[model samples]
Target: MTDLRHRLDAFVKLGDFFKEYCKYAKNQTQIDDNQHAWLKKFDEILALAGHKNGWFTPENILFSLESWAELLTPSKLESWLMAYEVDKNKPKSVALIMAGNIPLVGFHDFLSTLITGNRAIVKLSSNDQVLLPFVAQYLIEMEPSFKDKISFADGKLEDFDAVIATGSDNTSRYFEHYFGKKPNIIRKNRNSAAVLSGNETKEELTALGEDIFRYYGLGCRSVSKLFVPKDFNFDALFKAVYPYNTIIEHHKYANNYDYNKAVYLMSLFKILENGFLMLKEDNNYASPIATVFYEFYDSMEDLKIRLSQEQDKIQCIVSKGFIADEIPFGQTQKPSLNDYADNIDTVDFLLKT
Candidate 1:
């Protein structure tokens, strides 16, 4: 078997560990003495991560882990990679500069680098510094061959042949300036949006709430804008999303909501809010935290064309049969391994490099 096969099995084993660990954390399962050590270590890691970054709530951290665990199964990994010509590539030092907006946000690039016979030199975001290294250590332990395949960058990134960097629009310019000479994929800021027709059922609208509120709307895949029909009544949306009302209890989220709401009020901008979430009419895609920007559309065809033209600014569209390749509501966070970010195939890019 190729070393890639061993890497695949190692990831599968790590997935199993994550699944079991989540079960144990939730008290759905118990661990014996042999497993207690690992459980304790992970417990410490999750706690420290939450402590370091207030946005990294324990629930959100576990959610991210469980989401990745579900995707790293044997069938899922093999099926996603089969499309790429991975075996023909020579090893290159791939520098991965990750963004910290969401937990494990840059993991796909790291995984792509290693799974395609490349070495990874990762520079983690300060906001999310701890989790990926723990994951890497597990992978290395699972298959000793991986020890040489992955390494973390400390101060300066050097001797890398290719790059995959994620940052805001401003930082992306710097990434391009520094790494333009190399084979690179430098991603800038992008946000997701929902196209809502007035005819949506309560269930679908409720599901849309997940697309809006998960990770408190920090993830690129989180829906931050809405394109609604003219004169759309938001009573249904407010009511359907009421279950997530407790989100305001988080101090950090509440602070953002309070601050943004105050600024809008002082500026005399018309707004509607449900105490926990606010909606403002605007054309921008990237809304501030605790708020969603929306615009009314008179024609679906025109709206589709507009979205197509602005595809670069969108990570994914959350809707129901609203457009081809529409992501079902509530599933934006549950992306398959094949759902490449920014519609760029990282695995293919690495293999070609």
Candidate 2:
């Protein structure tokens, strides 16, 4: 335990290393020749990670990584370490079943295990196998010890001290049936949403474009549904978001939007009430594709009732008047260094194990 604590303290310095790494990462044009080589590798991995047509642009990855570094403040890291009690050093292994819905979804599990001083056996999703290793490769250059903490595994989950698994609802059943006996942070489908008081101006509404299209609306934290007052005007909202139509040019994204738009149009066989697609709300938070689906409410009480009914399906809700302060939306799944996933503090979870 004493030796591990010293290693953990040394590992903590990597946060400082990442801070510098991010500085090198930020200036795309200014990056030197050697830096460009690594950035090119990252770009390749991004392409392999289901982000065609600059979806995983080097600039965006750098920006997101910078934001991640900023969130890993000294106080924040101290709190995380305290939560895990690195000195106590309860040696445990965590099996992380990664998700590929968005770029770097699996990295949070990696961050959790590393900061908590737990050995992680990662099960990489086929769709995201490239990005995680690429990031880890650079981190290992910063500190070779990281190599001892992370291992890439193929299709086997045994001798684990605990598990953290993320999957669709169907796969969740399988995870639970197979892995429930162990201490686990198992999760099912979740979507992010926002509520409107109809008071937003063009600027604020435009930021909603970030909330919706930042990752092309593929993220669990992406705003899927919006709650609006019964007489809410869609004109202003649509106009604010029109600039993001560039997203429609990406072939894969366009395919999702076009295909789902076709299904929605065919199913409704009518123009939407406000010209936005409306599909029958289901028990699912994930919509079929290509459509922004939402429900209308006449009163705040009604909105709360609706939210309570759908709470299990929701991940985060962004609202002007109806939302509580605890759940932040734009920052969903791109959680703060302290912001735990599925409301479980990973450091705490690991320490308890």
Error of 1 at 258 (Å): 0.6
Report the Cα lDDT for candidate 1. 0.92
Model 1 lDDT-worst window of ten:
30-39
Q: Tell how far residue 153 is off in model 2, in angstroms.
A: 0.5
Put down candidate 2 lDDT per residue, 1-353, tens digits, no spaces: 45454444544554544455556555534555756677566556655654443456555555566666665565666665664456675777889999876667767778778666777888987766777777677766656677787788897777788999999889999999999999998988888777877887787777777777766677777777777777887878888777777666666667776676677677874424222223344434576545566667788887788878877777777765565653443454356666656667777777777
Report residue 113 deviation for candidate 1 (angstroms).
1.0
Name the regions of candidate 2 deviating beyond 4 angstroms.
Answer: 1-44, 47-60, 82-84, 271-284, 326-334
Name every residue pair that clashes in candidate 2.
257-290
* C-alpha lDDT of candidate 2 relative to the true structure: 0.68
- The 10-residue segment of model 2 with minimum total lDDT is 270-279
At residue 104, candidate 1 shows an lDDT of 83
Please report, in order, the local distance difference test score of every candidate based on alpha carbons. 0.92, 0.68
Candidate 2: residue 113 Cα off by (Å): 1.2
- List ranges where model 1 is wrong by over 4 Å: none
